[model samples]
Target: MDGIVVFGAGGRAGRAVTAEALRRGYGVTAVVRDPERYAELAAEGVSVVRGDVTDAGSVREVAGGAVGAVHAVSPFSGPEQGFASLDPDFFVKAADALLAGLASAGVRRLIAVGLFADLLGANGRPVMDDPAAFPPEIRPFALAHTAGLRRLREAGEGAVDWLMLTPGGGLEPDAPRTGRHRFGGERVPEGAPGLSYAELAVAVLDEIGTPSRHRTRVSVFVPREARVRRT
Candidate 1:
């Protein structure tokens, strides 16, 4: 059977995607910076490769023979990688490196994890730009993620076949999966923001099998009932 390379397979979203792909009987290569960190996945019959997407050559080598790749790499680390590296532009840098690596590896199809950039405030600007958009601590992350979306658009268009899966709500673990979701682009959708990372993975893997949103930024909206229970 063919395989898929999932960069940052250690992350929550990446792990979900890996497991989903494996459940469907597709060979999965879990790529991470440190192989030891993802030893558990290796034991699960996955081909774990200690590779960094930041290093194009290494990714190129690791991605060989894979049918597709997922850009789940994120550089924000409060203590593990140091908080100083959490800049919006740094997100762009990592994405660029991943793009170069994918291109060199001959992988044409890519489904990336992106943030909600289409959320506009009264000022006609992204909610991330508003000081009150979110708590100060998390604002930087939102900004960086939004910037990541722009970087994906600016870089991925025409160069690579890519889909930026922007979930409308927080990546909630408890959110119910109805196998249902709505898709859109640019402008953010209105409703409660809560998308199960597990369900989000389904969207990613589904697109990989039969991609229709090539080189575009798309958002998924789960039903409001899926996010909150009735009293």
Candidate 2:
């Protein structure tokens, strides 16, 4: 078994995760729709594979023979009607397609990137549990995240080992990797200093070799004072 497969390796956080994993001496297979777009990734020792996340064969070709997989892939475009329009089935469609491939290829461990919306509030209840919790402009995306979480949970079904790394509400792609971090079980406190993509990449690479944190949702945060905050 080599290193993990990085799905959606061309995205902001995805690229960071892949690069950090490579730096840590892990063999990386960068799965992307445009493999050529990541010629630099190949130049850096990643095996680039082009595939559709929603297609099972396409996924297995990339995920096979791996100890673990980092599922950073997402489909930003899909079609559905009504509230279902807000359904995260597009994510599920892609993930389920990948999961089947992973199962067949005997790749069990999985680290998935989920949204902060899936996390609980100060009261220890999921924010999505209250329809009024989020603003109208964001509810659709939040609900979509909830849907994706549900899909991942159902896919686990006590058969597969997996973890969902949920970012805090304020997470962004700014800042550099300080290698500073704290871990939260299922519900990291809301409004905490959120993580930067670079730091998140560092954390993911660290967690990969140590699977003690298996099947858990780890929330990320930066210590206060490292960055500016807004009201």
Candidate 3:
């Protein structure tokens, strides 16, 4: 009851965050659409529950008595899953629900994972806008993610202290956790090598324990030299 509540706990990022939270000795409440699907996630200190990230009522119900919350939900998982069923306002709804629900539940911190495609490239344009940098077909998904980020900004110092950690490059699931990452501003860092989901989880948990950023989005990546030396 006194640990973090993680939405989309079945996803790779969500699972990594959950694992990291548990490793840090924090009890976890893993919220997923279908609790049965993630039964394996239920452990001695972890509880897998059914909840909706876009529904304020559901979020409030599941996130009650939590230290903080994580929004790791993704409507589009991969390129194989086309954008036909993707909702442009999915993240907007999520932002609204999370801000309201977390506030109502007395949880102050909200950390949302972000898409790398929306990060500005060296050309001063979104990576998604550059076909050479990102897949044009995935632009819609990036737009939705960016819209959610915009909603969070528009909230403007509301009850929930939120931070969006946008990956500068790729998120390698199979990579090792070096426990090292670099943070950047709006634009992607020069020669930014990506970090692992585990490393991302480290950043997420670090923020929850001792928040360094508030109501802003930052690019998180591993420097090319750091990646080479650490790996």
Candidate 4:
């Protein structure tokens, strides 16, 4: 694998992944619908391209010839309590575009940032299927993520190498990247379940080159029970 392409490259997770990849000396292409908004990525020697996850033609043009691509595009914001609101079908369409684009571009690998909603909970069912898994505010995005995972499975699970990385159901905002976190298949990482954006980025980049979680789900979480009150 040579360079990497990032869809939704302007968002928090996407930006972190792009910066980390550059730091590790891998060429990167940041695909964004608005190039001006993410001009900083271009300034950092990354290849900035105008693209949208809903447009297959544009996606194919930008993501072609890359080693892999990360679908980290998140645009909508929920109520002040959480940033998790979007049209129900947005991610499904995004998944469709990614599938068409990667197939056309001949890119064989895709790593998507998934929600904990799709990860199996303690009851051995995806959180999305379990009622009361999240508050009403986050339900829209959670359902969108669930739909996106289904689309990915239908389109690329066997056709192209794909992986889903979930952040243990949620994360702490504005936390330091710490370069510290832990990951497991589908269970929570002991306690507090939160993983920093920076550490999650590390796990994303690490998985791209090494590919330990292909065609499966990997949950990166905070280690040692962050914020646990000692007895």
Over 1-231, each residue of candidate 4 has an lDDT whose tens digit, in order, gives 389999877887888898888888889999888788777788898888888888789888998788888999875645564654356888889888888888889888888888777677777876766677756656677777888888877764455688888898476556666656667887655552676667678788888888876676678876754434311
**How high is the lDDT of residue 188 in model 3?**
81
Model 1: lowest-lDDT 10 consecutive positions: 222-231
lDDT head-to-head 1 vs 2, winner: 1
Best by lDDT: 3
Overall lDDT per candidate, in order of appearance = 0.76, 0.72, 0.91, 0.77
Q: lDDT per residue, candidate 1, 1-231, as tens digits?
A: 989999889998899899889988899999988888887998999998888776778878888777789988777634345456676676666677767887887887888887664466456777566666544565667777777667777873555587888876577866665567667655556663557877888888888998878888787777775544321
Model 2 quality (TM-score):
0.81
| lDDT assessment of candidate 1 | 0.76
Kindly report which residue stretches of model 2 are placed more than 4 angstroms away from their true locations once superposed: 77-87, 123-135, 156-159, 188-190, 225-231
Please list the Cα RMSD from the true structure of every candidate, rounded to 1 decimal place: 3.1, 4.4, 1.4, 4.0
| TM-score per candidate | 0.87, 0.81, 0.97, 0.85
Q: Write one digit per residue (lDDT tens) for candidate 3, span 88-154.
A: 9999999999999999999999999999988899899999999998999999999999999999999
Return the lDDT, model 2, position 84.
42
Give the TM-score comparing model 1 with the true structure, all chains together.
0.87
Kindly provide the TM-score of model 3 when superposed on the true structure, using C-alpha atoms.
Answer: 0.97
For candidate 2, the per-residue lDDT at 188 reads 50
